[model samples]
Each structure stands twice: as C-alpha cells, then as structure tokens.
Target: MRADRLVSLVLLLRQRGRLSAATLAHELEVSTRTVLRDIEALSAAGVPVYAERGRHGGFALLPGFRTELTGLNHDEALSLLVAGLGRGEQVFGLGSALASAMRKVVDALPEGSQATASDAARRMLIEPETDLLARRAAVDEVPGDVAAEVRRAVFAGHKLRLHYAAAGRPPAWRTVDPIGLVTVRDRGYLLATRSGEDRTYRLSRVLAAEELPEPAERPDHVDLDRIWRDRSTRFRAGGDQVAVELRLRPSRREELAGTALAVLAEAAEADGVGGAGGADGADGADGAGGWLRMTVTFQDARHAEWALWQLATDAEALAPPSLRTALRDRALALAARYDTPP
Candidate 1:
C-alpha cells in the first residue's frame, strides 16, 4: 500500500507539474508528515523531485519527467472514468482510491487524447451529484472503518462478527459468513449467511463489525450476481404477499404500478377490466369512469394501504377487506382530526 501511495504521489506530481504538500496530503488522505517522508524517499530513490519555498511553490518533479504508467487508449480511459462518475465508490469505502486511479487513467492517455477526453467527460452527466426533488439526496452514512472490515471479510473469505440494529428489534451481535458487498443508489449492503441461512444487512445499520480470523463457511466458488438474485427473489416472496384489486384513472396507472411491489394482473377492457383481490383471486369491478382495473401484489396490507393512501380519491381499492378497512380507518382518522374543533 505504501508503494502504491508513492506511485500515486509521483503521478500527482507528473500530472499537475507542482502541488503543495498540503494539497498532496489532502489528495492522498495522509498527513503532511507522511508526504514529506515520501518526498525524501522518492528523492533518495533517484527520482528527480525537488521542493521550493513560496506561497505558490511546493514539490515538483524534474522538467519533462513522466512515468511510463499503464497504457490506456483514449476510449478505454474515457470509459473507465465514466464508469465511476458517481458516488457509488463511496458505498464501498473506496472514493479516494478511485479518484486517484481515475486521475492516473486520464494522465496515462496520449497527450492529444487527454484534453479531448476530459472535455467530453465534462459534458456527460452520470448520477448528477444533486437531486432535483430534494436538497440533494442524503448520503447513506456507513462508518468507514466498519465498511472496511466488512469488505476485508468478504474478500478474504472470512467470517464476520456484526453488531446490527434490525428495525423493531434490539441491537444484537451476529456472526455471519460474508458473501459479498453491494451498493445501490449509494446504499451499501453486506450479503452473508448465518448457519447456512441467507442474511443481508444494510451497511448503514451496522453498529460495529469485526473480521473473524476463522475461514468462512461458504461455497468454494461464489457467483455474487447469482447469489444476490436468488436472495432477492426469496426476500421479495418471504413477506405477507398481500394482493389487492384497484380501479384508478388511466392517468394514474404509472404511479400505482410504480408503488405496488408487483402486478399480479392488469387489463383495460373497453371501459374497465375484470379483477381478483382475495386469497382465492376472485374480484369484480363494473367499468367506473373509464377506469382500469388492476390486481396488484403488495409486500403486505400495510404496504397496500400506504400506497393507496397516496393516490387519495384518484384510486379506489376494490376488494380485500383488510386493505379496504385499513384505508377506511385511516380516512376516518383524518376526517376526525380535521373535523375536531381546535
């Protein structure tokens, strides 16, 4: 790792011509003392690095010095940089290293291609840093040290001890064999198994983590993609799997479909469609307001109630007494609250 950091320091010097020790320390995520030590090390190793004292002056390599780094062609360099154009790297606790690598990749390009590629990259937007709906999306805050421990356990094929906080349950320590780490929309997850049973934990929810020295109990070869898919399938089906029938204005179809966990059946027959909203899957809706009838599956009754509540008067729950009653109770509560004389 020190060697890699040394190389990165040299690359930074080569790329920017000159950078202050403080700047180098910030970029390398190291102390200024470490930067001074590395400078001395590089100079002793026959690297023509020198320092100058001034407000603008800092460390610099000999003029016309360029390390023959990895040879990445123009498009290859651009593609690599574009792939990491988001905060996805932060989820895995590699943002600083990734940024250094990206710079190195760009600097490795042919001088003519470097500027062109950079300009093109500036024009392209991947997961813009700011969210339009909110005051920028709130970052999923996972402890850096814990994420490092989780990654080490996963990559080293070791078991891990986790202090996890599960919703509606007390925080407890758990021992799990980590399978892989995944990050989606900036949220990180550790997919593992406990006693051969699948377990997944949100990295943000981990209160503490420790990598166990003992070898993990896991398969010889791991197909993380396949493993994640299988786990996701089981997780989606493991819940209450509540089914509901709904009639909604044609315009609200996208909103309803997007909110429901899954759509069991959907049809728009002329004015309306047939429906089934019970355990036996039998339902009926007589064309109302040219509405479309849909039988959709929710994670549970609570999920269905929450979603239909958003649709308000625009959508109607047609069957499944549980869902209808929940919505009715919610409506009554809202009415009572608003009707009470303040």
Candidate 2:
C-alpha cells in the first residue's frame, strides 16, 4: 500500500505541478508527516522531486522530469479518463479497480497527452444517471456482495444458484449455467442457460446468489453481443403490444417517446395555437401552441394508459376508442375517490 501511495504521490506532483504537503496528504489520505516522508523517499530514489520554500511553497518535480512509460494517443487517453470518471465505474462493483486503472493510464501516457486528456475529460460527460428534470433514471439497486458473487461465478465458469425475485412472482431458488453479465442503461442482467433454455435475469432482482462447485456446461467461447441483441429483439416483439395515437404538448413528446416501445408515426396537429384543453376535447386535450399528434406503441393497454396519465394535463390519448374509454374511466374513478376530503 505504501508503494502504491508513493507512486500516486509522484503522479500527483507530475500532473499538478506544485502541491503543498497538506494538499498531497489530503489527496493521498495521509498525514502531512507521511507526505514529507514520501517526498524524501522519492528524492532518495532519484525521482527528481524537490521542494519550494516560503508562504506559497510546495513540493514539485524538476523541470522536464517524468517517468518514461507506454504512450497513449490523446483520444485513447481521453476516453479512458472520461469512462473512469463516469458512472460506468459503478457497474459490477469495480469502482475502485477502475479508479486505480485510471491513475495508471494517466501515468503511462506521454506528458503532453496526459494534460490534454485531463482537460478533454473534464469537458465530456457520459451516460448521466438523470434527465433534464433532475429525476433519476430507474436503476435497480443490487447489493454489492450479491453482484460480486455473480461476477465471480461468471468469470470462474461455475454454475450459479440464485434466490431470485422475478417480477410478480414469489422468490424462488434456481440453478443455472453461468454465461455472462451484461449492463445496459445502468441496469444489469445475467445471461445464462437453465435446462438448455436461454434465460436472462436482472441483477437487482437477485435476492441472493451462490456460486456452485461444479463447472458450468457451456461453450468455450460465445458471442455475447449477438446473444443480447437476439434476446432483446425477441423480447420487444413478444410483448402484448398496444399501439395508441395521442395528441400531447410539444414539451412532453420526449416523455411519451421514452416510455413507448416504438413510435410508429408522429405529426404536429394542424390546429392553431390555443389554450390547454381538457381530456374531454375531440382529440382528448390540446395545449397552448397546439399539440403534437403521435402514433406510438406501448407494451400493453395498461402501459399506454399509465404513460399518458403521467403527463396529466400536458397530454391526451386519441386512440382506438377503448383506450380513451379506459383513460376516462380511470380519471372518473380517481376524481370520485378524491372528491370528498379525507
């Protein structure tokens, strides 16, 4: 650990130019004395480290001093830096390992590339876990230990036993041949096989996991991307899909598109700008500046109603009559329930 800290100290000064003992201690999570000692050790090792004096003094490397290491092009270094700093590090319980790897990547880059990569990384953001409204996207919370066990089984090629809580089903135990793990949009899935049948289980729904002693029965190599694509295609095509037409405020178009399985068609209403209309209007509702008319597909009738209802006054379903009736009935029930003060 001390060795790692010493290397990190050198990297820090090399990157930041000059840093006070207190700053180094804070960055390295050690005491000031430890920082001073590490500096002495680096100097003794002929690392070209020296100290500045007076009020604005700090430790710094000699001019043109840097460790000779493998080089990374600016773009390559920048990608690693951004990914290391982003939310992807939290996937599969590798946050600390990813951070360590990032430090090493920076240390390996050519001096000029290191500074440029750092600056570019600061300008880029990847896969932010929230939207413009400050609402966090739904990422299921899987316990770290459970995720680690699953990851271990996947890497070790062992069968896995899962105490899984599948949606709307009682928690049950099942053993499956470990294939691989896949993460999309911050959600994790275990792609495996059960009794020769393909299966994909969400990591968050895994209440507990046990790595089995026996080796998994599987191919030596697998194309995981193709497998995931095939499974996703089947899932999208197999659902109880319901297509609905809706006229909604332009501002709410994205919200609608996001929840829908597929957007079959979209066109702005020809009607001129007007005030917000109620769900009782001929096309359900129209907002000021008119509304966008879209034909979108949802997982089911229930899904369609729920998506539209989320927009409240900003949207209205103008659909296959049945959907409109369902929405009206739901609204009436809600209205009646809230009619009297509770």
Candidate 3:
C-alpha cells in the first residue's frame, strides 16, 4: 500500500507540480495524516520532494528533478511511436503539436531507441483508396476547428450554441446540449439533443459554436455503439426493407469479412460459389468462384441508390425492381457523362 501511494504521489507531483495536503488526501481518498506520511516516504526515497509552511504552502518536487523513463527498451519505444503516427491528424488534432511532443519524447529515449523508432516510422504508411464522392461529402460535412471544439465540449459536458447549416436551407443558430462526437468513416458527427429531440449534426456543416454557461447533463446508460448500429433505420422513413443478394469474389469476401456488414451473417461455400447471408437476403447467383450472397435493409429506393454507389462494381443488387432500376439508371447516366468528349 505504501509503494502504491508513493508511485501515485510521484505521478501527481509530475502532472500538477504541487498538491496541498487536503487536495492530496481527497485525491487519494485517505486522511491528511496518511498523505503527510506518504510525502515523507517519497522524500526518504531520494525523490527530491519537500513542503513549505504558511498560507501558500504545499508539497512539491525540487526544481529540475526529472522522471526519466529509462525502463523502456528500444523495441517498446519504436512500437509506441509507430502506433501514434498511424492514428493520423484527426485523432490527435492538426498542426505540429503532436509531432513536436513526440519529438521531445523520442529525443529523451536511449540513443539506439530513437533510430529504431525513426526506422519504424519510415516503414509504416497508411493509404486508403480515394473515393471522390465520399471525400467531397466528408469535406463538405464539417470544418476541422468546429469539430475539435464540439469534441472538447462533448467531453467537458458543456452546452454549445452552434450556427449550423441544415440540409437544403440557410444556416440557423441554435443551442444544443452536446452529447457525443461520432467519427463515422471520414465524417465527423455530433449527437446532441435539441428541443428535447435527439439529433445528429455534421460537424462540417457547423458555421460557429460558442460555449454555454450551463453544462449539459449526459443521459444515463446511453449506448453510442448501439445508436450508430441503428443509424440507417433511425434516420429513414417508411421504406420497405429489401433483401438484395451479392456474389463477392473470394478476395472481396475476405475484405468484407473485416467490415461491419459482415458480422450480420455467415458466408458459406455452395456449388463452387460462396454463399453469405445478410438480413434481407434477396435471391440471385452468378458463376463467380468466390462470390457471396448477403442482404441489407434499405429504407427506400433512395437509400438503396446511396448503398449502390458505395458498393460500386464490387457487389450487385438483385432484388426490389425499383432499386435495380435506380442503380441501372445511375450507372447509365455516369457512363453517358464519361462517354461525352470533353
């Protein structure tokens, strides 16, 4: 217990520089006498900790004392740095702050560790195939600064007054109690409650956000994961759930296995064809060696249109005459536009 307390006291001193006895006692959930004893133990262990007496007195570390992380070996340091870089700028925010902070940490590493970390960074790269429509849609969705502020407010349980651009309308300013920030693929969304109604606002569509004096109360037992899972069903109105079958090539089947849609059903091999089931399995098949069949619920033909665009030529929709016709027409329109000479 003493060892644990000593470690925690060191961390607190490093993070906050100093702590009054009462503050330390509150944080450690111990009596002030115990906190005083822990401070004495830290000093005895040559931790360079001390306390001053008077109105402004508190426990503190001696100036220039450092907590050297000498325990981490070369491989450990490299692994951590490589992982941090792969998270991209959105997770860590833009600018050089993250990079700068990383540089300082790397610089403090043992000589060989820095080289290993640098090599690991050079060998690692993340590149996702570009989708122009999706990219444009994401860009038009939220600005980075507004998204960052919304994230901060969400975590701090603060209310925000946002000037937001609603779909097909002029921007309107409204007060929203920020609930959570959801990063769906490349898009950022804020799940909030306005006028007692739950709503999702695209961060890019926000023109401005101001902090409110009153902090919003977060709902108890709200499952964000479940909310996201039912997003399509929740957003759309009065559309028949259609079953569409798809025959994905073996390679594509492997790719789909890693996607969220794959969890809904199992893929089986039948007659030299892979048969994967989905929620709304519409019947159809092809001669492709590694193809799979799966069904997805579409609220309406319009929703199916969007799904078709995302699946592209990798999969096909083979049911609900309306959805099939919409996909065909859209493909034809795109072909015609491309065929026209510039």
Candidate 4:
C-alpha cells in the first residue's frame, strides 16, 4: 500500500506540476513529516526530486521530468505495460508504435524488475469474449477522426452539418446543434437538436460530419439527463403493462432479481408439473418445485415475446389475454415465413 501511495504521489505531482509538502500529505492521507521523508527517498533513488522554500515553498520535479519505470520493482513495471496495451488498438494507432512504446518501457525496467515483469505478463492474459469482440470490432470500424471532431464540436457548442443514415433509411444531409456524445455498451451516439427538436444519431451511421462556420449561441441550460429519461419513457410506451407469472428455477430466480422488468409478488414451492402451479394453497415441499409470481410490465407484445424467448421453457406469462394472443400471432407469422415454399 505504501508503494502504491508513493507511485500515486509521483504521478499526481507529474500531472499537477508541483505540490507543497502539506498539500501532498493531505492528498496522500499521510503526515507532512512522512511526505518529506518519502520525497527524500525519491530523490535518493535518483528521481530528480527537489524542494523550494519560503512564501512559494513546495516540492517539484524539474520541468518535463517523468518517473522512469526503471525504478519499479519487476511486478509493477510489467503490470503497467500490460494495462496500457489492453486499451485495444485505438490508442497508439495501428502498427508498431504501440509495440515500440511497450518495448521501451519494459527495456527501461531494472534487471530484477524486468524478469518479474516478464513473469507477471506471462501469467496474466486477457481473452475477449467472442460476441463482445464482434461488437467492439463493429464500433472500431466507425471513423474515429469524425467521432473526435463531433465530440469537439459538442463540447464547444458548435453547430454541425453532416450526412447521416438511419436504420432502413437512405442517407440524408442535415444541420444540427451538437449537444453531447453518449456511449452505450459498444456503440457511440450523438445527441443533438434538429429543427428545435432533440434526436440521437448513431455514430456508426454518420457518413460525414463537419463543424459549420456559423457559430450558434450556446444554450443557457442543457438538461441531458432529462432528455435521456424522456427518450427511454417514449421507447417504453410501445407496449402496455401485462401481468406475467413465472416459475423460476433456483438459479433463474436469482437471475430475475437483476432483471429490470421482473417484479416479485409472491414466492412458493415449485409445483411438480414444471409448467402448472397450484393456486394459493400449495405446500413448499415439492423439492426444487417452487413457483414465483411476478408482474412484468411490457412496453409492447414484442417485448413480452422477446422476454419469453430469452427465458425459454423455464418461465410463463399468466395474464392479459392480449399478450398471449399477440405472442401466438407472432409465432404463427414467423412459422409461415419459415414454412413458405422456397
């Protein structure tokens, strides 16, 4: 913990330019005397640390001086290098620049530390899940330069002219006042105001984006949280609330606790017949046979259908006759599509 604190202090000084001993002690949650002693140790280890006294008294490193990883004890250096590399291909651009940077950091490490770093690197390996990798690759294909420019314009309160394409629609050119960038899972979206109305455009669907010359006055207030909340509410309005009863297995019961829609009303032992459950008066001694009654409000029948599909044969919906009818209709429609003569 002390070593980590020392590293943090050095990094903080490097970022902030300088700090008085009292300030450093407060920031590091240590005594001023201890801070001074740590500074002495850093200087003794040839860290180029120095102190200034009087009215503007403080400790600082010479300008442009960075702590060399050579001072880290093996494990520390290796962990640092690996963590930097794990940021994916976005950082150092595609090519040998990243590899070269990693090599330099590793090569600068002390001999003993170098061996330890190598051992640590060998022991730690990160494997990207296949589905997640695919999603990331899709995001990576987006023009990074364009995204950066859009982000800058959003922060600077600049209007943007861009060619955009929405799902199942032809590309169209539009002018919008950029508001903010929102990242969800693996995709990025730009929230903007167009024709006095707010909209969200997926970054991947943006063909081209450039700042407009006519700078618009920044709004006095930008309520991003409210905008997002309203958007979500609108999306959920597609379907109405319908009661759903589920007979969840022990594992599925735990999983339901985390789901956004599942609301538990009652819990009892699962009935022997996996699909059917006894009403009100049921014994709890049916082995793993217990039923959990839940009320899930679906925005639309499609939402209920999808939820049912995900839960598979483990769960069932028990109310709102319209919901079951909609599910059956959808199933039959899909069956017809698959059953059609080729």
| Number of the top lDDT candidate | 1
On residues 1-342, what C-alpha lDDT tens digit does candidate 1 reach at each position? 677788889988887788999999999999999999999999999899999998888999999887775444333343355356356567767666666677777787898898788788789877765767656765688877887788789878999999999988999999999888776667788988999888989998999999999999988888878888887788778877888888766778989888787788887635334323322112223323465768998888878889999997667788787778888899999999999789
TM-score: model 1 vs. ground truth: 0.77
What is candidate 4's lDDT per residue for 1-342, written digit by digit as tens?
A: 566556656765664567899888877668999998899888887787788888888988887675554254433343344344443333211222233334445656665696688678779755353454465333334675676567557757788988999878999999998876655444566778888786788887888888876664457577877777777676555446555655554546655555435463756544454443233334334454556666655545566667766664455656666655666677788789999787
Which of the two, 3 or 4, has more lDDT?
4
In model 3, the number of clashes is 10
- Candidate 2 local lDDT, 1-342, one digit each (tens): 677677778877877889999999887768999999989998899999988999999999987887753344332343354464335435566554444456667777776798788888789876677889999877667887897799789978999999999899999999999898777877788999999999999998999999999999889999999999999878878868988877778888877888888888988777553322343354334435667878898889898888988988677777778888887898999999999999
Candidate 2: the clashing residue pairs are: none
Q: TM-scores of all models? A: 0.77, 0.65, 0.54, 0.51
Model 3 TM-score relative to the real fold: 0.54
Instruction: Give me the runs in candidate 1 sitting further than 4 Å from their true place.
Output: 17-22, 31-62, 69-87, 269-290, 321-342
The digit string of per-residue lDDT tens for model 3 on 64-108 reads 676653233332333355344433345323322333344445556
lDDT for 324 in candidate 3 is 67
RMSD, every candidate, angstroms: 6.1, 6.3, 14.3, 15.4
Give me the displacement of residue 332 in model 2, in angstroms.
4.8
- Report clashes for each candidate as comma-separated counts: 0, 0, 10, 7
On the 0 to 100 scale, the lDDT of residue 171 in model 4 is 98
Flag the better candidate by lDDT, 2 or 3: 2
Local distance difference test scores for all models = 0.79, 0.79, 0.62, 0.63
